[model samples]
Target: MFDMENTTVLDRPMLDELVPSRYALKIGEIDVLVISDGVLPLPTTMLAHNAEPAVREAWLNDMYLPKDAFDWALNVMVARSGGRTILIDAGLGLDPDLQLPRAGQLMKRLEAAGVNLGSVTDLVLTHMHMDHIGGLLVDGVKRQLRPDLQIHVSAAEVEFWRSPDFSRTAMPPGFPDALRATANHFMEEYGSHLRTFESSHEVAPGVVVRRTGGHTPGHSVVRLASGGEGLTFAGDAVFAVGFEQPNWHNGFEHDPEEAARVRIDLLRELAESGEMLVATHLPFPSVCRVAAEGEVFRWVPVFWDY
Candidate 1:
């Protein structure tokens, strides 16, 4: 059994010291590390799309969070099993043109944690969001970071982004073009190395990918099982205030209603089973568990060894 007593919680001051930028944990024999890619500022209004201003403010107030914007963390999970290094999601790469100024720190932080980029054998993408796949390339040209990297993504996700109609979708002003460009870039750069899978499949020894589409056409989650312990990498499936209000759809989701439905069901299952969840856009080191509270749910962040 995994020991919960050794877990430590770092305050903002200690976190700022960069000592807690990465968190280490183990699921059975698989060694896992949660690396920070820095935080990005996102308007609270954009996140609580379906909620009224008053309601959203109340929720933020309850959580002691800012009313206008949220400092969302970009956490990338790395797992080592059976002598293979697997990266769950690539963080925002070192792209100067990207709007978010605080992101794209994955490589540096990983190095600080003693991880080598060239050692990554598998890159698993939960979805194709810019923040998630940005690190797949360095400045949109080099694929030389990982010599043996094999890209894995959902088949549906590939089709959605590659479709000619993708550029004509009703997306935020400049997003459609950006999405098309990123998709085309990946196809051109990693076409031969890309591997698409169906509904649920084991990507690594103890890591399994399950399609939970809603946030995006190919949105999915990674479930790691070993030594009688399990943790789920909930890729944009839930964000701040999302655990408390699973039905509140975010503006970023391609299908808001479906996203809500998927979030509700997934949160319910995780809460009941007490599985650890590593959220991509929650607080730094975004490892938490869910607890069913009446009709909603609550976030219970894990404490790691300091």
Candidate 2:
């Protein structure tokens, strides 16, 4: 069984201070802001789910990350266009009892940026996982962080997450507590703004949603374009520098093979189209340029002065 009884509140001092070089980037007429919610402490064994021992080991070594400690970064993206503000995903909320201090800093960063969370017009949830939806609710009262912001989710994702079979599917045992709580919070407090879209739907004028299921039954990716340049917000499809190697499949994916295929195909398409890729877990300030190197790929960090 999983150890899921901790109710410790996360504070600023318990978070690690690992900020990405790029804090914000402007594409066309839109402003894309990146904020870190902190990182997850996962084990290396979690990445080799279906892979052979040797194969997984080799991939781990190639990535240069610790084979024993596989911690992943969690970042949130905020976009502004034509007087509209949208948040890509909610960050992991505060865990006050944890040692990490920097978690739950998105609100502070937004305040510093002069953007109010309450004024956000829309919230595009890529998936319903804890790291992505934990911040969706306010602590204690079970209320949405932005009660007025419209919430857009793929129809399939909503159906899968709310389905009776969700518990039977391959999920972390602790998934129910947080995810179910988030679902309930949304249903009760913010159901008015909840909107579900079908495949390849548009959430806004320039914001397009595409189905990229793998990590979850109905995972979706957001594509934004303004002025002329294109920017794609890949929720959890590419975590960290793993986007550089499209074939590198982490164990977090519910369907490793399908995830690998989506990653590889996305890398190829993004490489050719020259669209800026936004990685929710690719180090905070999580926007980068991807390049194809033979059969593999590489990440070129986009430097912003902050």
Number of the predicted model whose lDDT against the real structure is largest: 1
Residue 108 lDDT in candidate 1? 60
Best by TM-score: 1
Poorest stretch of ten by lDDT in candidate 1? 1-10
Candidate 2 weakest ten by summed lDDT: 1-10
* CA RMSD (A), model 1: 4.6
List model 1 lDDT by residue over 185-285, tens digit each: 76777778777888987878988888888888899999998888889999898986787788886767888888889989988989888888998988878
> How does each model score on TM-score?
0.89, 0.81
| Local accuracy by lDDT, each model | 0.79, 0.69
Reference-based lDDT, residue 30, model 1? 84
Model 2 error, position 163 (Å) = 2.6
Off by over 4 Å in 2: 1-22, 95-102, 140-147, 164-181
TM-score of 1: 0.89
